[model samples]
Target: MGKVKISAVSYTNTLPFIYGLQHSPVMDAISLSLDVPSTCAHKLIQGEADLGIVPVAALPIIPHAEIVSDYCLGATGAVNSVFIYSEKPIEAIKSLRLDGQSRTSNTLARILLRHYWKNETVSLVSGGAEAYVEIGDRTFGKQHAHPYVYDLSWHWQAFTGLPFAFAVWVANKPLESSFIQAFNDALAFGLDQRDALIAELPPRIDFDYRQYLMENIDYGYNEEKKQAVALFLSLMESLEDPKAAESLAKRDLPK
Candidate 1:
């Protein structure tokens, strides 16, 4: 077979995986494309890519989707990158503008507002809202502009007291077990070299990039993360249309 086309997130959190993929022996056998979280999921859904490191929320909606890696983009307490920035206080905000770059963060914002914040009056608007969901590097240094800056993962941790998995590596269909093993090894190699990777990055005044990557973000796919994923998906299903959720439930995905 030809080189497997892989779509991955373009955020700094993914730098280790990118480094591993590019520097490892598997580089010769795969092609990589960098994109926002939503686009990564879209490419796999449309068959434009063979695999993707996509938002966890996108998994239930994509047919035949299967997680293919032992690593993920996650947070233990506070993920500084995902936020709900509001000019007004959280209680006063009546509507929110969803981020154009990410679906998971947007959904997370809604779920947090409805359940944790206890604000069902808030509605989603296309634009011109007092509050907005922002994710990735765009959220850096921008917290000062809003009076109420809510960190989505932090709120999730407060509500559930569990680490949250934001994104995972997935494939549309099964691949050779050997190829999967090689892919996981490459990611592991990159993860092991995080210090070297951080040293090479340019300085940012907004936040401590090194500290954020090392302390806030968690990179493994273990049983705890699996439980978090399951709970998150169930919450997402509760927020979905009844018919749609039932149809997806019939597909035999973990509940």
Candidate 2:
């Protein structure tokens, strides 16, 4: 058989996983592609790749998807990367623009606004919204530009007292047991070398890269994360929009 194709997110948060995949023994067994979160999801859904590290929100739209790894991009309090920036406070904001590069953060922002912030008139826009959801490295050091900045992860924790899972390793279909083992080993190798990876990163004046990676981001797929995912999906189902609930239910596979 040919080498397994893998799609990974091209973000600083995924640096460790990328490093592990590139430097490990399994590198020869798989083909790797780096892309933005939306592209990663598209590749997996379209069968252009066998596996992808995709946003949790994309799971609902992907059929027969299975989370294949034991690690994820998650946050306990503040992720710092996913934010809602606005000139006006969230409650007073009339419209919200969804991030073009994100699906999970956008959904999280909408859920938080409706459920926790009690905003009723907030409408989602592709552009030209008074407030916008921004995710990934670009959001770093840019919080000062907005008078009202809402960190989605921090607010999720405050509202639900749970950690949030952003991206997860998912496979469209099952693969050999040996390959799965190798994949896990590669990810573990990357997690173990996080300190070295952090040191090699270019310094940033606006945000503390070390603290953001080491302290702010949680990189495990533990039971707590599972609960968070379940909670998030359930919340999505509760939305009044039938289309939104049906879309989220597609990934509500039995654990």
Candidate 3:
């Protein structure tokens, strides 16, 4: 068979997984493409890729995709990356816009605004002269510090009382049980070398990048984390098509 075509996010949090794939024994087994979160989802949905580390919000769009591994791009508390920069407090905002970079973070922002902040008129956008939602490293520097920022992960925590995972590894086709097992093993090795992963980070970021990776991120795909992933999907189901959401709810989720 030809190599499996895969898509992954070109974000800092995803570096370790990308690093793992680049150095893995299975590197030649997959053809990888790197894109932003929204593009990653689009690639999988368009059949350009067989697997993706996609934004969780895009889960409902895929027909039979299953989370293929026990690792995720997540945050236990404030992510320090995803941010909502507004002229007014979150509760006072009349209009909200998305950064056009991520599908999952965009949805997570809305979920927090709707359920946590009690706002009703949120909208998604690429950019605005007034206010906007931005994710990833571009959100740092002067823009991130100046606005009345709301970290979606922190907001989700305050509202749902569960850790938040924004992106997950999903496969469009069901793998043999053996392939799934191998994927998980690779993920474990990737996470174990997080220190080495941080060493390869680009120099644009000014923070204690290594410490942030160790402390803020949680990559476990254990039962508890799976439950949290289910919770996110359940909540997303309410906002999206209920019929499709119900079908997804019945499927065996990642663990």
Candidate 4:
């Protein structure tokens, strides 16, 4: 059998999953590449990787990607990593620069910004901050205390009263049940050894790295996660833009 080519996010939140893969039976059976969230999705869409932990927003961009596993990077509420750090309060913001991390987050930010603070016309451009949103390990504990930071997941809940899913494992094509089982077993191993995995991380990340990994992030693909993903896809489908609507409809996700 050919090696399964998997792409994962190069973020602290994904360390456990990577650690699981490293120690699992699937380790030698797979080849892995790591990239930023947006790049991970781009690589998968370009056919450079067979499976990716793709941003929920980018799922629609790929035509034949399937959910090969029931695992995801998610939070019940207030995922502490993805933040919108701003110089002023979010209500006072005019234009906001998006950290070039994940497209899913960029959309989530916009959705919340519009929903809760309806009076503020926030623009999501690629520039410096009147306010700015940053995700993953890059922003942890390095305080830019000027702008009022908003946790995207928390913001989502404030707007829609639902949990949020960030990224999910998606395969370019379907794999046999045996292979899927192997992958799940690997991930389970990784989750069980959270302390050992955190110890493996290097210093200089500028945060309470271990605590954040163990406490702040929830790495499960439970029923709530499934409902949240489905709701997000539905919202994307309902977008006024026809192109976005068609993209969501055409994504061939596994039932």
- Which parts of model 4 are misplaced by more than 4 Å? 203-206, 237-255
lDDT of each prediction vs. the true structure?
Answer: 0.87, 0.88, 0.76, 0.79
Off by over 4 Å in 2: 240-255
Error in Å for residue 160 of model 2:
0.6
TM-score of each: 0.93, 0.92, 0.86, 0.88
For residue 136, model 3's alpha carbon misses the true position, in angstroms, by: 1.4
Tell me the deviation in Å of residue 152 in model 2.
0.1
Task: In model 3, state the lDDT of residue 135.
Answer: 87
lDDT of 1: 0.87
Candidate 1: worst 10 consecutive residues by lDDT? 246-255
Indicate the worst ten consecutive residues by lDDT in candidate 3: 122-131
Give per-residue CA lDDT, model 3, range 45-135, as digits (tens).
8888988888888888976888888788888878878888888888877777777787777777776776667787765554563356788
Scored by lDDT, the top model is 2
lDDT accuracy of residue 72 in candidate 1: 96
What would the per-residue lDDT of candidate 1 be over residues 1-255, giving only the tens digit for each residue?
Answer: 888999999999999999999889999999899999999999988989989999998997777999988899999888889999888878778989999888788888887887678788988899699898989888778878777898889888888777899999999977889899999999999989899999999898877888888887899988888888887887787677787556655654321
Query: Candidate 1: where is the Cα deviation over 4 Å?
Result: 242-255
Query: What is the lDDT, from 0 to 100, of the residue 104 in candidate 3?
Result: 76
